[model samples]
Target: MTTPIHITHVIVGLDVGGAERFLLRLIDAHRGNPQYAHRVISLTGKGTLGPQLEAQGIAVTALGMQSLRDTPRTYIRLKRALQAHRPDVLQCWMYYADLLGGLAGRRLGIKRILWGIRNSHFESGGTRLKRAVRRSCAIASRHLPWRIVCVADSALEVHARAGYDRSRMEVIHNGYDPETFTYSDTGRHRLRRELGIPPDSLVIGSLGRYSAAKDHHSFVQAADAAMRQRRGLYFMLVGRDLTRENQALARQIAATPHPERFLLLGQRSDVIDCLSAMDVFCLHSRTEGFPNALGEAMCAARPCITTDVGDARQLLGQGGRVVPAGDVPALTQAMIHMADLDATQLQAMGARARGRIADHYTMNHAVDRFESLYQTAMALPY
Candidate 1:
């Protein structure tokens, strides 16, 4: 057998979140690529999905994070891992991974360095501290043979708007495969019974780590408003809290009125079933680059009512509705609209979201693009 070409992906963790899962699915899809075999390096502790990656014979390593905040040691630890693996190309996912991987790739003499930027709605301009964060890693990106890849156009635009060089950045839409995530009415019935959500109740759902950026609280606020408008409505929240920040938000959520009505299902395995339960899926994230949960909900054929952040408008196309990010009133109105929607109207709108995902977003498509990019990089003079 011919030897596989080497490409390493550095990420913060193997958590079952958007970017981590996306990388795993992409790696799984491209396993057959003769040009490069993939390795994943987790900068922090391994997440729940670590075992699955190992089971598939994918190499994964963790830095065993010692502190909550990033320090010089974090970069040094990542650099040691990079030196050992010595991959031909390095791809970093999320902010912490990007900064660390970029610095390590430069120090280790890696030929290609790619930073995946997924957050699209961060309008928090750089103060001295934020600028320091960007400046700390900007040198590695600019000086080395590096590229910044955004999963959505809005993400790419956000990077440029934040003074990142346009020429060095690219946008690639994450694809959705119906094979991995399919809509199931049968699953919906099963989940509704488990949660005691009436079959007739309008289900509004969002799935993500309880993070500030995800702005899940905004979704909760919208649900509160919707519940007032129409009593007995249901809302489901999936995914676990990973950090103190997200945990703080969850605590606040639980303390609110009718917390029981808001089902806080932490780190669920039956995502498809939960998606199935939602009649009208919503994500009121304050900012995003690409939202994996939003795509999954659409795949489940729910009428998507999302805040206009990330690549939602572009991705949703004409399939669903978009409101301004964090606008509780608008999100509330959208939720009420879903409450008012009959089965007929929902089916019509939802079919569009499902069709859009089936046609565009899929692991197969994303993997293909990545494979091609790797090939082009390998063919170039190093």
Candidate 2:
């Protein structure tokens, strides 16, 4: 019998973001599969998801690098971890990890390396330091890893244009586990009650961290516009730093006619239940790789309205509406349009959304692809 391939994943941190959540799901898919074994290393502080991974018997290590100043220490620790494990494949997530991990893997004579790219665009906001780092990574992408697995086709294209090796790039869309994110009437009722939302009220929801790339301001503006056109509409915003304490978000809410109608639940562990409570899911991201929230909402049988970022339009296809990114007017119109749909039409749209996810983007399908890739990588001569 062939021995199980040990794969080490190096990531920036295990925060509760899309990439972090997706990594946990990927690790879960490999459990009990004798063909593969996994280990994780976090370059910064261990976040909430590390414990969950440890509970599953996966080893997770934190290098405890607080900032750029700690890069030398992080590299030393990562190299030692790699030398100890001597994994069959070293998989790096995000840019910083890819750069550091790839260098370490090469230094240790690891033959097969894979880099995961999770964002379509780098909106550096004119930070010279960030731009310099991105450029350095782009230059390294030309020769470092055996394969670059992009979570979206858009991400591949964007990076290719930015000088990454097109031949080495592979698109692997983020996967959704239907069993975990399925709709629940009870959950819907419970979340609505907890949030003080009327059972019959129309709810439009957006899930993403409060970042410039997420462009929550656009979502807030769209929600405001939609609420102006219709009464009894509620908006749900979920993610870290999305509370009333956020000055920018608070100002946006205060601009709305019915600030009381907005339900800013901030960050919650019950994401599935929160998704179930929504009448419509919205993604107004200015940039994305592949949106986990959009897929989760689809799996929860909620129709979505998303911007034309990453592979969102392809993911939605005919199942949901797509608008131009950062377009407040278009997003507002889409929100209003979805709000006006009759119960039957909305149900039909949601069914299509759910069907699309189940047919094309299940966790099993993603795991199969990943396993095949791993096998191929393992077969290559060291």
lDDT of each: 0.78, 0.90
What TM-score would each prediction reach against the true structure?
Answer: 0.91, 0.97
Most TM-score-accurate candidate: 2
| Candidate 2 local lDDT, 1-382, one digit each (tens) | 7589999999999989998998999999888988889999999977989999999999999999998889999999999999998899899999889999999999999869999999898644547776777778888987789999999998999889988888999998999988767999998999898878986799999888899988998888888888889877899999999899999889889988999988888888999899899999999998888998899999999989999988999898777899999999999999889988988998899999999998999999888888888999977876
Residue-wise C-alpha lDDT for candidate 1, range 1-382, written one tens digit per residue:
7667688988888878888778877777765557568888888777887878888888888888765466577788788888877887888886667777877788777868888877774446445665566655544456654677889988777667666767888877787777768877788898889888876778788888766777877787788877877876888888786222456656755665666677767778888988888888887787777888888888878889888887888888877789998788999898898888789999999899888888888777787777777767777787
Per-residue lDDT, model 1, residue 56, is: 80
Highest lDDT against the true fold, candidate: 2
Off by over 4 Å in 1: 32-34, 68-70, 121-131, 242-259
Model 1 / residue 207 / CA error / Å: 0.7
Please give the lDDT score at residue 125 for candidate 1: 44
